[model samples]
Target: MIVIPTRLKSTRFENKILCDIFGVPMFIATANVAKKVDDVLIAVDDEKVLKIANDYGFKAVMTKTTHESGTDRINEAVSKMGLKDSEVIINLQADEPFFEGLNLTKFKEFAMEQILNQDAFMASAYKYIEKSEADNPNLVKVVVDENSTALYFSRSKIPFDREPYNDYKGHIGIYAYSVKTLMEFCDFSQSKLEKTEKLEQLRALSNGKKISMLKMESKSIGIDTKEDLEKALKVFKKVNND
Candidate 1:
């Protein structure tokens, strides 16, 4: 199952999800793409969003407006749904209308394998980013161990290079977990690193949970501002033409 946590307002782009993407609303477009791979449910914060989801014929549930993160919102939705503990779930961001170069089918398979193996409580993808682009604080960076297990995630540039190199792995916001792990993760209190970095995944790491990372060729463009929306529109047009 793929769950999208839809918050109506945004600090950078107010009600951005309602913004148009090639004639479709951003959140609805995200749902449309995700439904191609698996079941989709929008965990919405506002009733206005819920009505839109219902009108679009997508499954949706109302969540609290007080949740701090998308992950927390989806966890609440899943808990209310009564899915089995082992159900594989991908926390797909509503902001990501499309993920160029990623095969959602393969990603789902990887999530299933990792969750069933129980080696890691969570799974996520990272893509190689240029050294020049790595300095942008909006783009989160991740460092992984030899085994592809996440070592750390941060907004600032990592591994200060003595000699400049370009192997920076930009962290994709999407995350995968089994129902049990999702529940366990949300139960944890926000960690010091999480609050400091404003990243939710740090809570998992600080609590000794392992996150298996997969390297993929994806340029995930999550729309955070009006500029991002314009960028995404151009990218979407180029992708379709290609």
Candidate 2:
């Protein structure tokens, strides 16, 4: 199952999830994209979000507005649904309106491959970033070990670029996890690194959760500011017009 953790409040953009994209709300647009993957649900904290989900005929679960992170909300939402400990779940961030549903469909295959290995219950993805994206603080970067395991995630550029090297990968904010690990994630306090980098994936790495990351081609833009929304609007128009 794929669950989208949604909230009405956004520090960067006011009511971002509820913001209109073309015609639909950003979160509602994202839900339509994700619904093509498999069983999808919106894990919402606000009554307005729940109502929007219902209006769109999408399944939703009410979670606490107090959840510090989407992962926490996900744990609560799934727990309410009585999912099995071993159930696989994919988390699709609600602000990602431009994300391709096809990428998520393919993600399930890649994530399933990693989960079968037993060495990892969490899996994510990233793609090589252009130099222009390196300076963008909103684009989270990642460094992976030789085994494709996540070493670190940061809003700042990673690896320090000590030499003639390049090849930075920006993390796509999607994650797949086993229900057991999902529940365990809620019990963890925010790690020092997580607080410093402002990247929640650090909490998992700091706690020794092996996260396997698959490298894929980059696509879509995460809406952090109005500029990103405008770019997405143009992209949406071109795609639809084509």
Candidate 2 lDDT by residue in tens digits, 25-113: 99989988888888888999888889989999999999988877788888889998988887889999999988877788788888877
lDDT of 1 by residue, 10-84 (tens): 766889999998888899998998988899999999998999999999999999999988899999999899999
lDDT of each: 0.89, 0.86
List the RMSD of every prediction in angstroms: 1.3, 1.2
Superposed model 1: Cα runs more than 4 Å off: 100-102
Task: Provide the lowest-lDDT 10-residue window in model 1.
Answer: 98-107
**Cα lDDT, model 1, residue 174:** 82
lDDT of prediction 1: 0.89
Query: How close is every model to the real structure, measured as TM-score?
Result: 0.96, 0.96
How good is model 1 by TM-score? 0.96
The best candidate in terms of lDDT: 1
lDDT of 2 at 69: 77
